[model samples]
Target: MAGKSQAGGERIEHPFDPLFNEYSRVLILGSFPSVRSREQNFYYGHPRNRFWKVMATILNCPQPQTVEAKRALILEHHLALWDSVAECEISGSSDSSIRGVRPNDLSIILKKCDIRRIYCNGRKSYDIYRRYIEERTGREAVLLPSTSPANARCGTEELINRWSVITKDLQSQK
Candidate 1:
């Protein structure tokens, strides 16, 4: 899907609502949707992103294929998912090329859920959240490595090991 042109570049508006409910206990954030994610209109739509695999391994659930299944995997585990950015100018799906940021208001989810923790899927998301949302919420966000295929140095196993921290908070709430 093509984004709107802005200042001789493409500016994409986040196309989906945050996945969460009153029962959600953990909030997981990404910087913004990738081109593939935007095309599919879901988070981590890229086949090789490894987010679903990591989550499935840590949460001990099957890797979800369909959007509904993914939603179920998140909500059933008391997790919420969203991006830190509401809209931005990006080049193709490159996080390094991202600019013109407008942050999403996380209060919408925070207000409705008893979120015990906030996690950022990558450095970009963590940085964006800290810069834009952390002060308002007065919450610290844990930064996890990027699950994008571009982050090849951190394999699935390594990602799972790092991301297992999510389960700590999830289990504590249970």
Candidate 2:
């Protein structure tokens, strides 16, 4: 799927590597990186996005303010971060605009880590993962409400409540 690009004739590809380690027990997947996230080379780079806020609240930790802090948060919690799509054509930050989907090889992380549960951050991620990765991996991801600013339907309390499942599972493992 091709579309007009914001940068003349150039289409954007996913710009960052997946974040995971041998310690990762849970994998959290987004649809793809937004333009801002690509620029910042990190997941949830947009300041207005509530991903970090929701994560901080769920984990009872300070909100991550830097790339290092964000990495630390995920690593410390045995969480892995990645996107469902490895590469795609997108007009902007909109997930709806994504096309030419080439999904990430989740097995890279799956093989390296003992990931017990997989979680998708929003509808698109969940749908893609369900359609592609789940069948091959035999691991169905729990779909969580998006932390994107666009998803105004779920407020902080609701997000916190819904996202508690991740933390709950983490606790049970301990």
Candidate 3:
């Protein structure tokens, strides 16, 4: 279905595209895009999500309001963003109901870049990667608390604190 319309009559071909750089030092995997996120075409673009805010605070970068700025942040910090699932015909955003976890084509990035570490944004993502991708690739990944607004159990400060531990390498490399 090329350029199919959503229930709200908004035209969309697919969710946001995966992003990575040639010299990426780390990869952050999300489970799947929410409907709002799919419409916006960016990761954690939802205002309430606070992922960019947390990352900006942790990395000492300005809050990214636009997709270009977010891409710039990833490029500037050598961070990559993509989901564990490639393209699943799922009904909604709930990861528990996710099926057919067809792994994403990482060859383009893997061939061109040096990926030092893989970080899953949430437990659902990590679980999917463990079952689908990591088993095949033999690549171990570190799991971080989910930054989605849905994961209110882990507050922004806690999320950033956990993320800081993993991203210490990024600071060292700079």
Candidate 4:
């Protein structure tokens, strides 16, 4: 949980493993885990965060309310989930407060999965992915409006519309 210092504050190391499997075809990355997520030891643990709802709407599945259900959803859709930052100095959950970022080595999932497409959940994540992972992997990620509660500018409907792209190719195949 303790990480290196940056400026005056302490950075926090990412505490969980990336979620994926050999069947994974799409990769979704966030900037970093929020404090609530860190406490819950799962992605998008904040109640107000709409990530699970948005994904459920796009995939035509019931929204997940528990970690087990969330994992099931990701596995069922052949999607991988992780964060762009392996560690960073952040004040609360604000992406703007992030500094001294150490990006995650996404090759853990990339090497194990087919991972046809990558999608960043927010601007910070998108920037981090482009700066670190994209060049190394030669895989460009699509930017999706964040489902974070902080991103109130994008409504639930808009998020679903934008996020539907993740399932578009799969839907066509079915």
Cα lDDT, all candidates: 0.91, 0.89, 0.76, 0.90
lDDT of 4 by residue, 1-174 (tens): 765465555589999999998888889999999989999999999999999999999889899888999999999888899999998898878899889888999889988878888899999999999988789888888999999999989999999999999889566544
For candidate 3, which ten residues in a row score worst on lDDT? 1-10
Candidate 2: tens digits of C-alpha lDDT, residues 11-118:
556788899899999999999888799889899999988999999999999999999999999999999999999877676788887766778889899999899999
Ten contiguous residues with the weakest lDDT in model 2: 1-10
Best by lDDT: 1
Per-residue lDDT of model 1, residues 1-174, tens digit only: 346666555887898999999999999999999889988989999998999999999999889999999999999999999999999888888888888889999999999989999999988999999999999999999999999999988998999999999998888788
Model 4 C-alpha lDDT versus the unseen true structure: 0.90
TM-score (C-alpha) between model 3 and the true structure: 0.86
Q: What TM-score do all the candidates reach, one by one?
A: 0.95, 0.93, 0.86, 0.95
lDDT of 3 by residue, 56-82 (tens): 888887898888898898888898888
Deviation from native of the Cα of residue 166 in model 4, angstroms: 0.9
Q: Show how many residue pairs clash in every candidate, following the order shown.
A: 0, 0, 0, 0
| Candidate 1 collision pairs | none
TM-score of 2: 0.93
